[model samples]
Target: MARIAVIGAGMGAMAAAARLAVAGHRVVVYERGETYGGAVRRFERDGFSFDTGPGLLTLPAVYRDLFVKTGKQPLEECVDLVQVDPSSRHVFPDGTEVALPNASRAGVVQALEAALGAGVGDRWGDFLVRAREAWDRTRRPLLEEPLWTDWQVLAEREPYPAVPHKRLLRTRRAGTLAEIAAWELRDPRLTALLDSHALAYGLDPRDVPASAAVLPYMEHAFGTWYVRGGIRELARAVYERCVARRVEFVFGAEVTRIVEKDGWAAGLELADGTVTEADHVVAGVDPGRLRGLTKHALDEDGDVFPDASAPSPGRFTVLLALRGAREAEAAHRTVVHTPDRGAELNWVSGEGPGPVRPTVTVLRPDDPALRPDEEHESVVLTATARPKGDWAADGSSKPFVEMMVHEAGAAIPGLRERILWQETRTPGHNGDETGAFCGGMPAPSLAGGKGYFLRPSNSTRLPGLYRVGGWSHPGGGLPHAGMSGALVAGLIVEGPGFRGSQ
Candidate 1:
């Protein structure tokens, strides 16, 4: 059996550890923090709890496969995975509200039409049909398998089939998401709805390729989910699975460097001046930090290296401890669209001070585990923001936090008066939890933008070294991170010929 050393106790790392252990490898995980789960953290105060990371789960089949491969106990047995009906309720800037049902195309179409006018639903439904084509075309190479050697093929070609349009004697097709919204949807509210999907992932819809249609398609196809307690419980389940598989975990053992011997990834060096050798090393870390941990160039010439020039966007969140009970019919998730899309996009692009009102997402789960009693409620308000925002300063993020509460007032009844307490989190806090640069969240790798959006390959230039996490192949988000683990494990257990789960 090969001795495997994993860096970090993040979900991706633990997923890989469990699979490798079941494959008869002696796996040891070294995490810098005192606990596992990386960004999947929880905050509690006065008997209230809040998930500081992702609030919902999409594409849960990824985790289901993880549990199925690792042990006899499936994912459902470990955690209460509930489907969120009306996947989300959107409140547009123009005061139009629509609650889209989860994984129901016909229902979503009917609801959109009812709320957005006569023909709006058909346009959205048609767009989704096209989006499904994009998903089917890229799902295998992008998510289920390791990033291909000729990944540029996936990058250079746009998988999203854009409708042809004649403009000023030129017959062209929508290339960017902005073009799709303008040309196809042709409604301002529709544009806002389309942009919100990209914004949710901290992506700029204006520049992201048309292939990004897959994002919404994935959600519509698989449905959105919520763990019974919080997303933290999902992390707990994965960690437990790792332990059940006999994976050794060393918490608070910060890895200083990736030890190299004879041009291969030999092992890990801890911060305490101690070293442990392994036959293989799997690094589940940010690309920027990984580069610093190794002297050897992790990516060779012509490899897709993680982009460092443009900083990924981060999230600003406010946890609200409210005095009243949550309304019975309240949507589990609500997105309040920004009035000014251009200004919000400009702020996210780091070109401006930020919009007076940004798009806000408010999550209010009905679970009693999050509240102090039947009379109280716990709510979380979040917005995508610049990664380097000076949130550490006293009241630096107060204006934005207050704006979020103001916007959420549109969704929640008596929102401003219901607050009993509040706790805010910045990208700086995310950086502290996940060691990600600027606590910025990485978007899933896309198949267009001339390969600019693709992440680095799992197998680095260094032999016996692999990367597994949101920062690597398949890119970010919960499902992608889990898929990255499966890919890495397949590569290690089945050799370089591993094409991914068949």
Candidate 2:
């Protein structure tokens, strides 16, 4: 068994630690933040609990397999999730409603037919079928398997047209969300909503990949879900699992650098200057920051995890613990668009450190336990691509906080009154706490593809180091992070003296 140190305690690190420990590795995880969960974190104030990140979860079976593979049952401990029906609501610029299926093809199509018109249903079905093929063909070979080599898994997942993925390759240097929307659907409204879905990971539909057309399909086919408690509890469940598996956790101890010995991973040193030895070190944080964390044993070839071909998009977030739930005419998840309406990057102009404005991602916490008094309510407001350092003038200025809170209330309907408590976080806040990762791109920006089969593998450049979580492997989001942890463990088990094939 390898002596391993997981350089994070978020979903990715925790998942990896649990899996590694179960496989008999001596594992310890280090987290810098006061609370764990990384992006899946939760915060409470004024008797209000807000899941600061990852408000919803889907594809739970991926997590179940992780726990089961490690010899435990996930459901027995963390949560009893209820599938969120009418997966989500899509509001068009023209003021129309399309209720996505909780997990049915016909229901969603019918909704679309009613909202977008007759032929819209057929196009959606066809689109979903193709996406299903993508998911079916790629889930195992690409997402479930370890990354021994980049293209090996890609090739396997993309064995298409009854054989070979060469045809799927797009020679275009860059593909955008807008281009793809135009290709599939005709109506500007339908196309725009399709592009807007790219915002799920903070991508502007215009710049993301056409292959990303699979997002809606997966949500509808598998279904969106809510864990019984606040979403942050999901992280707690994984952490609890890790403890059960004998994975040690060093919370609030931020890692400064990964020490190397004779050009190999030796161990890690915390910010407090404590050094621990290990045979393997997995950085469940961000790859972009990995080089800075590890003490460099100079290589003849300066190869590092060098950010993925394309990093995921990053944005700002606002979590609100409200006095009561908004009685919406739509489902829990809704994407609102404007038909040449006002407010197009207007609130943010001549603002932010990078002179950039951010989009928003609004989520209503499906958790019933978030509020203290009767009618506990939570509203997650989000959009994408904002200046990371501008919030609160490096997160210190008092004026910035007041300014942003006011802006949030104005942007959304009934936001200010219902909100009992509120908090605003920038990507930089997440990066500083979690070693400056998860700010640039969502996993889809990096992993979404025409040949998603060729996405980055879970393997790290350093010996005995693996990656998981939003910034790695199956690439961001709760469900994919679990798969990454499981797959990486499987690969580690199938080492040089492997007993079986992965």
Best by TM-score: 1
lDDT of 2 at 163: 17
lDDT of 2 at 495: 62
Q: What C-alpha lDDT, on a 0 to 100 scale, does residue 167 get in candidate 1?
A: 63
TM-score of each: 0.98, 0.82
Q: Model 2 segments beyond 4 Å from truth?
A: 148-176, 295-312, 324-330, 338-361, 394-417, 445-456, 496-502
Q: Write the per-residue lDDT of candidate 1 for residues 1-502, one digit (tens) a residue.
A: 9999999888888888999999999999999999999888999999999999999999999999999999999999999999999899999988899999999999999999999899999999999999999999999999989888888899889988857556655555677899899889999888988898888778899899999999888888899999999999999999999999999999989899999999999999999999999999999998888888997877767765447545688988899999988889999999999989999998887877654699999999999999989999999999998768456565658788888889999999998888898999988898888888888898898988888788888998899999999998898899999999999999999999999887
Instruction: Tell me, by lDDT, which candidate is best.
Output: 1
Query: Which window of 10 residues has the lowest lDDT sum in candidate 1?
Result: 302-311
Query: Which regions in candidate 1 have their CA more than 4 angstroms from the true location?
Result: 166-171
Deviation in angstroms for 82 in model 1? 0.6
List model 2 lDDT by residue over 13-125, tens digit each: 77777878887899988887776777777677777777666777778877777677666475646676788776766666456657677899888778888888988977767
Worst 10 residues of 2 by lDDT: 156-165
